[model samples]
Target: MTSPLFGQMMDVPLLASSLLSHAARHFGDTEIVSRRIEGDIHRYTWRDCEKRAKQLSQALIGLGVQPGERIGTLAWNGYRHLECYFGVTGMGAVCHTINPRLFPDQVAFIVNHADDEYVAFDMTFATLVDIIAPQCPNVKGWIALGDETCISTHLADMATPALSYETLIGRCDGDYPWPVLDERSASFLCYTSGTTGNPKGALYTHRSTVLHAFAASLPDAMGCSARDAILPVVPMFHVNAWGIPHAAPLVGAKLVLPGNCLDGKALYELMEAEGVTFSAGVPTVWLGLLNYMKQAGVRFNTLKRTVIGGSACPPAMLRSFEDEYGVEVIHAWGMTEMSPLGTLAKLTWRQQQLTPDEQRHLREKQGHVMFGVDMKVVGDDGQELPWDGTSFGDLHVRGPWVIDRYFRKDDSPLIDGWFPTGDVATIDADGFMHITDRSKDVIKSGGEWISSIDLENVMMSHPQVAEAACIACSHPKWTERPLVVVVLRPGATVTREELLAFYDGKVAKWWKPDDVVFADELPHTATGKLQKLRLRELYREHVLPTVDEKVV
Candidate 1:
């Protein structure tokens, strides 16, 4: 018998260009504010952005950029960078965002690996471009992300054949048409930071990007809307700035790009100037802003909600933002492999109906997965663990936007079609996933496992502690024990006994840190995550207090 079915539906492909077209047609007048690297505020509208992006498309075509050709951008979050995002993708070329924070050699490696034919960069990276350009011979030319005067007057002595971005676009007639490209075609490329090894590029499709934008714009995700002015302190090179560059336009929200200046004072000033209502960035950036505000006796004038990711957000940071600053902190977790947005900490209705303290506890966890993501924890036997909130295992996730394989690689990183997220986590009965530790960061004690994240969270909650990172230190009896390296608040002092006493009733006695060492500052990765590998190297030979015969 023939299956019963409804009438035929339209099969329009979801493309990234459609987003820009929608914004241009409906929200053309929406603002796109940027703090330029030249120490000035540059303002424009979505209409202007659309026009210039089209002009950029024409310029690239004039430069012999073919469809699917890789175009590299080593710039910060700004109007010009946004134009590159649309211009490159709209014309069916892949937009490869190279992280300038990566080592010069690493940057050259990524550029050469991607086989990028063209590069565009901010003036701040002119010297960096000069160093890496010689190594990246495949790069056809460099386009400075500024006007002719800014390039000549500022970067006059640069040896690269750098063209002015404005000049390149000005020569175009702004009449380029976006091609009818396949939805599954590659649109963007972002390389992993290579913390463990060499960086691997993750090529994303236009369809996946559009779907990610839709998921991020929903209320359960970023909750972006036209009424909100969004500031992305995260740079464009990192997972497309957590996909905010697309989400903002999808929802018609005002875009505020914080160019080269990510310092707390600069961020605060730009946020206030733009009347930013929402923002997304790492925990370290927010900590700096909070500290500056506390010292200056100032508060967020218009900023309301912030999504803290790139690493686990401390409970103290969350509480401070909600209690003292009247702003909400949403703890998000993701990786470059997942298009950088896997989970967000939005409370469910049942959880929200609970007491404020109960809700806060729920929020402290990573919360639940968004609409487009499927998550599960699996044991070593490759069996799925129960969501009882106790069985911690390797976290694996699969989604339309998730990366299945690295670019230029034949082997796949998927197991049973799900990408292993490299996170050890627990899923509660309500579907809330708590990241206990990274797969490599989890401390394996004598025979049991200890959660470094739990210990670090407790230590950070202490009033005197500013930042904390727990690493497994070698122990004679126990296979491994946690040694917490901490950075105390300015002018704050605390003894090791007092700090250990603070954790007395908080965690298990065996889970207690073996030692507490203080430092003036802690090392961090380019994306603001604590560099635990460096910490491990620094404290590899650190011996516990030695006693006569007991070795205590």
Candidate 2:
């Protein structure tokens, strides 16, 4: 037997710190603008950010932080949070980003589950930190991401004396060098939204993070470039802001971080003022911005494209951006376990030549797979489905960046080496994937499957409907029926009968919702995805009118 042959090549491992170093060396003058929680704008360059990140690492070392330990962050998308992203991971510590929007008990549960040694949070989370501090006994200390005045006034009464972010880093001269660890060393830890149960952690390594950054910055993915000003409306705590914190620096794109001011007006103003050419966020945030623009009769000056994910992007929202505002809406889909980037709806050159309407329909799909991810649809027997654009099945994916098993869990979540995405979807011959519905949210009525997403999209197209959520409700004849809960536009009037009638020609007769209920708002998860689990619980016993009539 012949021994395996190997080629001579450089063996340098890919690490997250190298990304910042590259940006600082080549794109040192590029700006990273952020809207501060202090009602002011903060500006810095990539070189400055690199220096401060090193200082932060040194400060953490001075405070006795060790490699392989978990350092938690409970802050929004801002400079300090950005520093923590690189510094903590660069020094071989796991950067655990906890979503502050979660319930207090959930937050405490995450901190305890991860065994975070120290928590660094923004001043805005002072009250929340104070409430959860007693519950998280393992946390050695708390660090406020603010100046001395912020700590003295906001966090003075904490159970433990809180350290100030500015003061802590000021003492260090940034002399510490980043450690060169194995490429598989853990770099980031993110927990799911826990809409079903307690949030589970997905641990990411240096190699995976670096590879994810490379794929995320591709021309077909987020399309990041140094010539563009990129704004990530997604919170930093959510899957590393969909990997933009890493991708932006990789491509030297000017970063504009909107810190907790997610309302339409503020976002529009920030984008305009900062010359943001590209942005990414959840559909809910874009809806607010679109509503504001429609009401104010305004238009964007510089924003050219936006990546909409965290939930299904309604067709109406996509039309509003492309047809009305001239902004391209790239519908995306992913989960925390996949490092949050699986596919982006970038049309191929062949598809782009199709008629405008044809192209629009193609763009509505979740999209083609990125280079690093390999996906397929499987049936109940775990057999692969055809790519005929009609056969829908469970979506499974495997990739270097994708999680093999969740943190601290003994069992692997993968079946046959592929992670089930919990999404029911179809793929066309061109390799474009369209998500029909979540497996849990798909409505089955009298043995017929009805896509709640399809029903909601139709209802959302109506002029009066502000938002809609379609869920399964009990039926006497049919096992289940679709019930749509709708929130109307302000000052708009539409009766339940009228709204239900509007769906007449849009869908099949049986596919139409059986009942329409007006609601002030719909429940959303911490990551901005619809909370269908909560809705299912809330209306599990709800009876359709036809069923009620039979009962009467």
Per-candidate TM-score against the hidden true structure: 0.97, 0.98
TM-score of 1: 0.97
Candidate 2: pairs in clash:
none
Worst 10 residues of 1 by lDDT: 543-552
lDDT of 2 at 456: 95
196 in model 2: Cα distance from truth in Å?
1.1
Whole-model lDDT values for every prediction: 0.91, 0.92
Q: Please, what are the lDDT tens digits per residue for candidate 1 over residues 427-448?
A: 9999999999999999998778
Question: What is every candidate's alpha-carbon RMSD to the true fold?
Answer: 1.6, 1.7
Residue pairs whose backbone atoms clash in candidate 1:
none
Per-residue lDDT of candidate 2, residues 321-357 (tens digit): 9999999999999999999899999999999899999
Top of the candidates by lDDT: 2
